[model samples]
Each structure stands twice: as structure tokens, then as C-alpha cells.
Target: MLVGDRGSVSAELVIAIPLVLFMLLAIVQFALWSHATHIAQAAAAQGLAACRAQDGTAADGQASAQQLLDELGRGPLTDTNVSANRTADSASIQITGMASMVIPLLHLPVHAEAAGPVERFVPDLAGGR
Candidate 1:
């Protein structure tokens, strides 16, 4: 080891250690965000199915989404809001929330939406048309 560079390793570690730790935390934070997003999407799709059924109501859609969140989202997802709407020809559901925080002051938001034409029976029109 050169006498002029005797303390270089110590200097490098001072910078390298924090950088490595930050990278690891970033990876963990991203994983948590992804998991939270999937949970929201599943809940939204389930609620959309309930809302799009021929006999389903808007309340049913919201309830289903809330229930799914309660069952699956314990820590990763937080401050969730579920909304549902049905019109004459269509139905929709939205799930929105924040992912659990890992990096301080870094709040990640998660959102999911599901929509489809209302389920209904229609007579064959091929012959008529």
C-alpha cells in the first residue's frame, strides 16, 4: 500500500456503504409498491364484476371491493378509496390508495380501474339484420 493512499479504503467505504444501503432500500420499496398495486387491481376487478352483473347494484360493487381489500390488504396498501358507478349501458369500479412507505417521505400511490358493458341477454339479430 502506498503511504500517500493509506486511508483510501476507509474513504471509499464511507461513500460506498450508504449507497449500497440506499439501493437495497429502493429495491424493497419497489417490491412493496408493486404488491400493493396488484392488490388494488384485484379488488377493482372483483368489484367491477359485481357491478356489471344484470342484477348487481353500485353498492354491491363497492362492498365487494372493500371486503377484498380488508382480506388481502393488511399492510402494503393503505388509505384506500373504492368507487363504483353504473349507467344504462355500462358499469365501472375504481380502487385508489397509497402503498406502504419504505423510503421516508416517499409516498407511492396505487390505482386500478375496471369497467365493462352491463351484463344482459340479447336476442339473435343475425337473421333479422
Candidate 2:
């Protein structure tokens, strides 16, 4: 090794190790955020389906969403909020949560919304009056 370049390897390692670790952690964090978002979307869809049913209520939607979150959002997703709204013509469900952090001090938010027309029996479509 040259006298002046003797410590170059050590210096390079010092910079490279943390950079590599950070990149790896960033990839893992992205994955966690994606998974959390999927969970939130699934919960929202479940609640929306429940609330849009013929006899479904907003409370039913909220309960359904909260149950799903309890099952799946306990780890990858945290601090979840579930909301449902049902009106005469439409029903909607919203789920929001923070993705579990893999990188220190990095918090990612995940949100999902599902909405559809409320189910109803139509005499014209059902061939009955």
C-alpha cells in the first residue's frame, strides 16, 4: 500500500457501510408502507361492501373495518382510524393508518377510501312492482 493511500480502504468502508445500510433500510420501509396501504385499502373495501348492502348501516361498516384492522393492522400498520358514512343513495368507507417504521424517525401515512351506491331492490330490474 502507498504511504498516503494506506487508510483509503478504511475511509471508503466508513462511508459505504452506512450508505448501504440506509439503502437497505429504505427498501424495507417502502415495502412496509406498501403493505400497510394494501391493508388499509382492503379494510376500506370490506367496510364499503358491508355499508352498501340493502340493510347495512354505518355502524356495521365501522365495526367491520375496525375488526379487520385489529387483525392485520396491528403490526405493519399502526394508529389506525376507520370511518364510515351511509346516506340514502351512497355509502363510503375511509381507513387511515401510519405504516410501521423500519427507518428510525421516518413515519409514513397510508390511506384508503371505498365508496359505492347503496344496494336496493328495483322493481324494474327485478321484474316485480
Candidate 3:
């Protein structure tokens, strides 16, 4: 009569492999999310820069952002929306989109916004009496 545990290691490996794979998938998803966020932020910054430049327009900002996304955001971002707004003193750009799903059936939202004052010459104030 032999009493021994022969399938313990194999069973453990079988159970642990899937868990490890899931963890790896989660890590990949997080990396994708981070990359998407950085791309969005960069796009927003570029748009803001365009809009805040001298003689810049909101349309120009929007176009700049859209171009960046179209060029660099192929696999990681989808359904992108770019908006640019300019006030009397400031300009802002916003990029919004959905991040690619690394996990099955999961969708993540990503957004980035950048704002700055429009560049203009301010005359030096002379001596006040």
C-alpha cells in the first residue's frame, strides 16, 4: 500500500499559471492606460501651444490635436474628441478618448486638458506720479 501525493505540483502549476497570466494581462492593461494618458496630455499641450501662439485660432488648435492623435494614437486610443477654446486672456485644449482594452470587455476613459495665457506684448509701465 503506497500513499503519496503525485498530482499536487501539477495541480498547483495548473492553477497558478492562469493567475499569473491574468496578472500579466492586468499589467499590460495598466501600461496601455498610462501610455494613452501621456499621449492625450501631449496632444493637449500641443493644441494649447498652437492656440496660445500669436495670431493662433481655436480651429488651429483643434487641428493640431487631431493630427497628433491621428498620427500617434492608432492602437491605444479610440473615439477621440478634441476641443479648443480661447477666452480674452487664455486658451485651452482638451483631448478625450477611450483607451484600448487589454482586459476583455473592459473600456477605460482617458482625458487630458491644457491651458495657458495667450501670448501678447505688455508695454512697460512708466513712472507714476
lDDT of 1: 0.95
15-87: candidate 2 lDDT, tens digit per residue: 9999999999999999999999999999999999899999999999999999999998898999999999999
Global Cα lDDT for candidate 3: 0.92
The lDDT of each candidate is 0.95, 0.94, 0.92
Model 3 TM-score (2 dp):
0.90
For TM-score, the strongest prediction is 2
lDDT of 1 by residue, 14-95 (tens): 9999999999999999999999999999999999999989899899999999999999998999999999999979999999
Instruction: Evaluate residue 2 in candidate 3 and report its C-alpha lDDT on the 0 to 100 scale.
Output: 41
Error of 3 at 105 (Å): 1.4
TM value for model 2: 0.94
Per-prediction TM-score to the true structure, in the order listed? 0.92, 0.94, 0.90
lDDT preference between candidates 1 and 3, better one: 1
Candidate 2: pairs in clash: none
User: Considering only N, C-alpha and C atoms within 3 Å, which residue pairs clash in candidate 3?
Assistant: none
Clashes of 1: 0
Against the true structure, candidate 1 reaches a TM-score of 0.92
- List candidate 2 stretches off by more than 4 Å: 125-129
Better of 1 and 2 by lDDT: 1
